[model samples]
Target chain A: MKLLQQTILEKGTVLPNGVLKVNTFLNHQIDTGLMIEIGKEFAERFTDSNINKVITIESSGIAPSFFAAHTLDVPLIFARKKKSLTLKDNVYTSQVFSFTKQETSEITVAKEFLAENDRVLIIDDFLANGQAAQGLIDVVKQAGASVAGIGIVIEKTFQPGRQILEDKGYRVESLARVQSLQDGQITFLQEQISVTN
Target chain B: MKLLQQTILEKGTVLPNGVLKVNTFLNHQIDTGLMIEIGKEFAERFTDSNINKVITIESSGIAPSFFAAHTLDVPLIFARKKKSLTLKDNVYTSQVFSFTKQETSEITVAKEFLAENDRVLIIDDFLANGQAAQGLIDVVKQAGASVAGIGIVIEKTFQPGRQILEDKGYRVESLARVQSLQDGQITFLQEQISVTN
Candidate 1:
């Protein structure tokens, strides 16, 4: 978690959209060593959860979740945001609204892939408002599966996502929690912000 | 590679669109163990290429390439198919025509990720017509990075993808090369086909 925090401090940039961009090493262009360590952290945090599978949304979450799943020795399933031509099977779909895009899109997982008996751990790049995680939860519910916990690499705690998931009784663990990214300076939840008296 | 071939034999299905579907383990719902093995296999196969980074296109390519990058101890960069609101910098863009969409889409990678001194290994979920790989190659070219080789989990060799890439002087390696998927039976290149006999 400290390493992730340091990586954020070094490589992350605060965008005008009130978001933290970790494009340099988190998602777009990945730091493999950091990801592997992140995976180990996730596994350690959720070791008692009896997680049978890891689930995530496509594009950004795949890489990190893949490593986590590998470390846990479980399968990983990513919900597809857009259905492609080759994906013609019956799928469990849920609508997820993107605050960034300002539109809702249907996210899906093949109905047959997720079994009812499996316990899943949901992993993602960042948990902001938790819409994406909620969408994945909806899909898992449709398949009669149980979500053991939620593992996030970064959590924007200023948003209501963690509270929302916690209210629903899902065990949530995030390696790095951003308290604020205001005025081009990033702040984490557990770290003290310098207050000039 | 043998495990990949076995996975295809046991779980892969041939869709009516003449595509071999490995949605059960390869793409949609990933078998994390299989993927890790696939990663090691790719690393073993391309060990001598001196690949400093693994490059891929977003969505499906993320999982496999992530493992391969981890195994190779290199960074992984995935070219985003469309630019997002957060992506507002100088990027290396390439237009790729999608046969499914019947239109061209722009694929981009941030300029800073791919460096001129790097030797990249391009990894993809499937290689059918090489449009995706070509788009990535174009981005690497923009960065002045040299492509060591292209690694594919599966290749529909009947398509022009491998031919197109090979003609461009890129060494391509596929774990499972699908020769044909006629009559709902997936066939690989090594197995003697009755038609050829």
Candidate 2:
């Protein structure tokens, strides 16, 4: 967690209008070593959750989630944004609105992958408004499965995503919680008290 | 390699129209233990290539490529299919035609991540007609980087992907060289000689 928070401060770019660009290390150009550490952290955090599966949205969430699933010795499933030819029918679908792209896309998981008895751990790179995480949770619910926990790499605490999921009684664990990204400066939740003091 | 080939035979599904679905392990629902093996195999195969970076397309390609980059102790960069708000300008872009979706999408890699002196290894989930692979290669070339090699999880040997890449002089190492998916039987290239004899 220290490494992640440090890397975020060192390499992350704070864009206008509450956008944090971590593409240099977290999403686009990935730091595998950091991801391994992140995976270990998530696995350790949810060690007692009895998570049987790790689910995430495609594109960005696969790396950290895959490593977490690897460390936990579980299968990692990514919900697809678009229905491919191979992924036809028998799917649990949910709609996710992306504030970054300003679009809503259907995210789906094959029904064959999730079951009623499975305990799912949802992971993602960024938790802005929690639309993506909610979508994944919806898909898991459609299969009659239970969500054990939510693992987020970087969370925007100023956003309502964490509160929304917590209100629904999901245990949300985020590696780096950004309290504010104002004036091209990033303030983590933990650092907030000290900064204000 | 044996593990990957065995996985393909045991879990892979053959659908109509040259679609070999291994979503059970390779892409959708990922087996991380197997991916570790794949990373090790790819690292061993390209041990002498001096690869400084591992690159791939996003979504399906992230998992295997992440492990490969981890094993090789290099950074992994996934080209984005769509430009998000955070990823604006200063990018190297290429058009990729997806046979599965029957659509063309522009894949972009941030210019800062790639360098002119970088030696890259391109990894992908599947190499069917080599369109995706070609698109990745084009992006790397745009960065003025050299592709050290190409690693694929599965290769449709019956297709022209391998031949097209080989003709272009890129060293392609596919764990499972699928000879044919005819009659719903998954055949590897190594098994072809014996199957014919």
Candidate 3:
């Protein structure tokens, strides 16, 4: 988490809006070494949660979640942004509104992937408004699975995403927590506190 | 690769419209163990190509590409399906038509991530009509980067993808070369031949 925070401070760009552009390493472009470390961090955090599967949304969420699933030695399931032609019927679908894209898209997972006895750990790249996380949680509920925890690479603490999920009683662990991005400066929450501590 | 072929034969579903759905293990839900082996296989195949980066399209491609990049100790970049709000300018863009989706979308990558001297290895989940692979190759070309090779998890040899890439003089390595899916049977091009051989 310290490495992630430092990477964000070094390579991340603050857009005009509240967006933090990490295309260099996290979003558009990925650092596999950092991602593997992030996955190990998540596994170390939630190792005793009895997680059977790791679920995330398509595109950006796939990389970190895949590594997490690998470290956890479980299967990784990514909810499709839209239902493709081959993915017809018998799917647990949820409508998610993306604050960034400013559009609503349905995320879906095949019902055969999740079951009542499964414990799922949800992972994603960013958690701003938490719509995507909520959608994955909804899909897990539809399959009668239990939510183990949520692993986030970067979280905007200024946003309501963390509060919303915490209010819902879901444990959320974020690697980089940005307290503010005002005046083109990145401010992390509790910068002095070590992640390992 | 043998494990991958066995997984395809056991779990891959051939849809009515010539689409083979391997969502059980490759697309939707991923087996991390298998994917790790896939990354190693790709690393072994392209070990001498001098690849500094591994590129892939989003969603399903991220998993295998992530592992490949990890094994190769390089960065992984996934082209965005569309230009997002954060990814505004200075991008290498290419148009890709998804035969299965029945729609065309533009893929974009940040210009800074790729360079003229970069040797990139492109990886993808499926090689059907080779449109996605072509789009990635175009992006790499636009950045003046040379493509080291292309690695595909499943290649439908019955389709024109493999032939097209081969005709263009690109080195393509497919883990499973599916010959036919007629009559709901998953047939490989050479079932008896070992991938290691």
Candidate 4:
């Protein structure tokens, strides 16, 4: 988490409308070494949980989710945004609104892939408004699987993303949690976890 | 390669319209172990090449690319289909037509990611019409980088994908080349070097 926070401070760019671009490393042009580290961090955080599968959305989240899934030695199931012609008719779909794209799209997963006994750990690159995470949760519910936890690379904690998931009784752990971006500087919650909190 | 071939024979579903769906283990729901095998095979195939990076497009190609890139200990750079607001204005863009989706989509990579001296190996899930592969090649060309080789998981040799690349003098290698899918049976060109010849 400290390394990720440092990487964000060094490489992440602050865009207008509260958008932080880590495309140079995290999302677009990935550093496999850093990706492996991030995956290891996720594994460490969720080591206590029983995770059978790692679920994520298309595009950006796939890379980190892949490393996490590989590190955890679990299967990764990504929900495709665009409906492929070859997709089977029977699929569990959930409508998701992207605050970044400002469009509503449906994310789908094949029903046969997720079983009732599977415990899924959801991973994503960024969590702002938590729409994407919510959509993934919907797909997991439709499959009748258990939601083990949510692993996020970066979280905009000032927003309602984390609160909503926590309200639903989900364990949401982010590598870098941004408290705010006031005065053109990024703030992170780097406090060590207490022995009993 | 044998493991991959066996996987295809077992899990791959040939759709009515010639679209082979291997989502169970390849794309949608990924098997990390098999993908690691695939990565090992790709590394073995291109062991002699000077591949500094493994380049691929997003969504489907990320998993295999990750495995292959990690095996080779090289960085992986993927072209994003949609330009996020966080993306810079400077990029190498190319239009790719998807036969299955029946639409044309543009893929772009940040200009800073690739350099003239970089030797890139292109990787993708399927090589059907090869538009996606060509589009990736175009990006590499735009960056003034040398393409080391093109690696594909499955190649539909009957389609015009391989011929176009071969005609362009590109070294294209597919793990599983389908000579013909006749009577619901797949014929592989394991002993043959060039499917076109």
- For candidate 1, the docking band is medium
Pitting candidate 1 against candidate 3, the one with the higher lDDT is 3
Q: Which of the two, 2 or 4, has more TM-score?
A: 2
* Candidate 3 lDDT by residue in tens digits, A1-197: 89999999999999988789898888889988888888889999999999999998888887777778888899999999889898889999999998988999999899999999999999999988999899999999999999999999999999999999999999999998999999989999985745774
DockQ of all candidates, in order? 0.68, 0.84, 0.85, 0.74
Mind sharing the TM-score for model 4?
A: 0.94
For model 1, chain A alone compared with the true chain A gives a TM-score of: 0.94
Local error of candidate 3 at residue A126 (angstroms): 1.5
TM-score of each: 0.93, 0.95, 0.95, 0.94
* lDDT tens readout by residue for model 3, B9-121: 99998998889999988889989889889999999999999999999998789887777898899999999998899987899999999999999999999999999999999
CAPRI grade, predicted model 4: medium
- lDDT per residue for candidate 4 within A127-196, as digits (tens), equals 8899999999999998889999999999998889999999999999998999887666788966677797
lDDT of 2 by residue, B105-144 (tens): 9999999999999999999999989999999999999989
The lDDT, on a scale of 0 to 1, for candidate 1 is: 0.87
Model 3 lDDT on a 0 to 1 scale: 0.91
Q: What is the lDDT, from 0 to 100, of the residue B28 in candidate 1? A: 82
Off by over 4 Å in 4: A195-197, B193-197
After TM-score superposition, what is the CA distance of residue A129 in candidate 2 from its true location, in Å? 1.4
DockQ, ranked from best to worst: 3, 2, 4, 1
The DockQ-derived docking category for candidate 3 is high
Q: Where does candidate 1 clash, by residue pair?
A: none
What fraction of the reference interface contacts is present in each model, in order? 0.84, 0.96, 0.97, 0.87
DockQ of 2: 0.84
Return the clash pairs for model 2, or none: none
